[model samples]
Target: MLAVIRYTVPESQSQDFAKQGQTILDTFAGQPGFLRGRLARSVDEPNLWALVTEWEGAGFYRRALSAARLVMYPLMILMVNEPSAYEDVHAQDGT
Candidate 1:
């Protein structure tokens, strides 16, 4: 499963945004079923960012968020309101 949280950050706050994203990723790392995660900025729109996380499943992802709400609220509250959870129907690896 995948969880993608998008955010629109001003140019002035990009650095802080990246730092906060890293912190969130770090927090997720300690949770069960956290496969991996990344912090990315859109190439076409520099101010557009995403915190993408891969989890074992939607249940695991939801549990992680619910457990970390206290530590995550500050930045989590800034994410754009949209459907962020997804299931992988098909996946291919370059290798």
Candidate 2:
């Protein structure tokens, strides 16, 4: 499963937002079933940021969110909208 959280930060808070995003990635990195995660900024919109993460499944992702050590929840609340989760519908083999 993939989780994507979008944030629209002001120019003055970009640095702080980036730091908090990295902290989220680090926190989830050690959790069970965590696949990978990345932080990205939109090319056309400087203040638009995205925190993308891949997990073994939706359940894994949900559990990670509830973990005690996951302190990124507060930062996540700053997202412009609710986070999104997606399921892979295509095969890597391209059948």
Candidate topping lDDT: 1
User: Distance from true position, residue 90, model 2, in Å?
Assistant: 1.3
Residue 17's C-alpha lDDT in candidate 2? 86
Identify the runs in model 1 with alpha carbons over 4 angstroms from their true place: none
Clashes of each: 0, 0
Question: Candidate 1: lDDT of 91?
Answer: 93
lDDT tens digits by residue: candidate 2, 6-87:
8888889889888888888888897899999999999999989998999999998988877724567666656877747899
lDDT of each: 0.88, 0.84
Stretches of candidate 2 off by over 4 Å are: 68-70, 91-95
For model 1, where is the 10-residue window of minimal lDDT?
69-78
State every prediction's TM-score relative to the real structure.
0.92, 0.85
Cα error of candidate 1 at position 86, Å: 0.3
Quote the positional error of residue 10 for candidate 1 in Å.
0.8
